[model samples]
Target: MTSQPTPFVIGIDGPSGSGKSSVSRAVATQLGAGYLDTGAMYRALTWWCCHTEIDLGNAAAITRAAVELPLDIGDDPSAPTVVVDGTDVAEAIRTSEVSSLVSTVATVPEVRVEMQRRQRELIEQIAARHGSCVAEGRDVTTVIAPDAQVRILLTASEEARLRRRSLEVHGATDEAAIDATRDQVVRRDRDDSTVSQFTEAADGVSVVDTSDLDFEGSVAAVMALVDAARRR
Candidate 1:
């Protein structure tokens, strides 16, 4: 007789415009699991940094003050809400300006420590209720959810990723801006390279290149991996 499959955590990591967000959500929907965006937490802090005029270069100051930063993450999978200090910052956290600077604020060791703690706790709680999680971010698979039963690293060619980002935000309606935004993602990749330590090999990890698949297709790929893991 087949034993009951164990509930597990799924990690999806990739560079910007690699469809991590869209595909992760789709996979969560398919699996009926919770979705946590580790990047947005950093983005929220970045938003706070700019709004409060805090210098990003100082790690000590940021650490001491990081605890005071109000971060609210709602449980709704369809619409996860993020608020900082009572202000609804869900939309603000996704802006191009915030996106561009999030990595700067996130690279701080203190900030990563705090954020990583919160992310891990949140994942445990969500998995307890939902039975599993399909968490995605720059470091989810490698660092944040390294113990997750299933881990996947998703990526795509730079050019393809750029096109996807353009289409996601505005499609053909804003080709020039899409190209510009792609350049920003690339710059962010370069800036984040040194700070990122999320791709170190784990005992078992499935890496996929999403350069060819659309959003649904990528999600399907992740789900297939989950099925294989559950059967293991």
Candidate 2:
């Protein structure tokens, strides 16, 4: 029998619009690794709550939903999927309704506890299968995979983050779009901050600022860090 090679895990944390998701996915593809989006787990849980009519304000109820969530998330960087209870919800979880309320569900202590447990397990499985895995989210560095081979905290200025998010969601970077995108990028971060620290790089975790970097530039910056870490 052949022994499985040890996996190289990369943990990345960043606030919304910091480009962590896109950058991490690209890096995973470049390295022939699996990808995990921890935030999408929270979003899937929130969608389940809404689908089952669980009260988001009720901590106990939300926690119960988290415990019973039948979530199936894909690890492919090129074609990730999120499914719940046999239904594909990758798109539903990204809807405005889920976006507005996901923070509430994510802030529940028990929910984070449950989700983090599952996330750790998933990361291990993904890495074992693909030889490497790149996991990114608000707390992947601090909470989920602190001991990963490479850790990164991606960041961007508030103005730059807001503009990027506006362009992503509203398809424009005008003043109106920025104003509309502020709540999603800023308010969500504030609420999530209560549960996880992502704005600053923790000890031994490298920081990558994408405030001025375009998509390709951001990917290159993170890949450079990955290469340096492997060399060290």
Candidate 3:
């Protein structure tokens, strides 16, 4: 009888527009591991709240929604899906409206606790199924999986980050496009910072600055860290 591979977990944290999602996905694919985009959980909850007519400002209501959020997220890096209450919201949750309000839902203490609980469960489930898993979010490294075998804080300079985000959102990196993208990347990070410390690396966390790296380079940098961790 063949034995299953031992499971491991990789946790990643980064600010908005820092390539956390893309890099983590790529790394997970290369390692043949499951991928969990924890940010998508918050965004899914925000979408659910709006869909149910729950006011974003009502903390108690939002907390209740979090507890009751019927979210089903896929762990496959190449083809991840986010479905809520039988509706595939993979794209809906990425809309500008959800982007603008996700922090509001994510900042509630009760919501974080609930989301963290779910995230931890998902990480363990994915790792157990796939032999390894990569989880990325604003607080994955610090709160969700601080003891992950490979913990990374992927970051880039503000200028680089804004340019990258502009290209992703507007398909252009001109000054005007970057300026237009600033609010989504900068303001969102600022709001989320009030609840999570992603801009800086926590103790024992490795940092990978992608200020000048392309997508492949960013993935390589993160993969290198995972390899080094595995070696230890």
Per-prediction TM-score to the true structure, in the order listed: 0.90, 0.97, 0.97
lDDT of 1: 0.79
Enumerate residue pairs that collide in model 2.
Answer: none
- State the lDDT of candidate 1 residue by residue for 93-120, as single tens digits: 8887887778778778787888888889
Alpha-carbon local distance difference test for all models: 0.79, 0.93, 0.93
Off by over 4 Å in 2: 1-4
Native-referenced Cα lDDT, model 2? 0.93
Backbone clashes, each candidate: 0, 0, 0
RMSD of 2: 1.2
lDDT of 2 by residue, 1-232 (tens): 9986679999999999999888999999999999999999999999999999998779999999999999999999999999999999999998889999999999998999999999999999999999999999978888889899899999999999999889888999999999998988999999999989998889989999999999999999999989987887
Candidate with better TM-score, 1 vs 2? 2
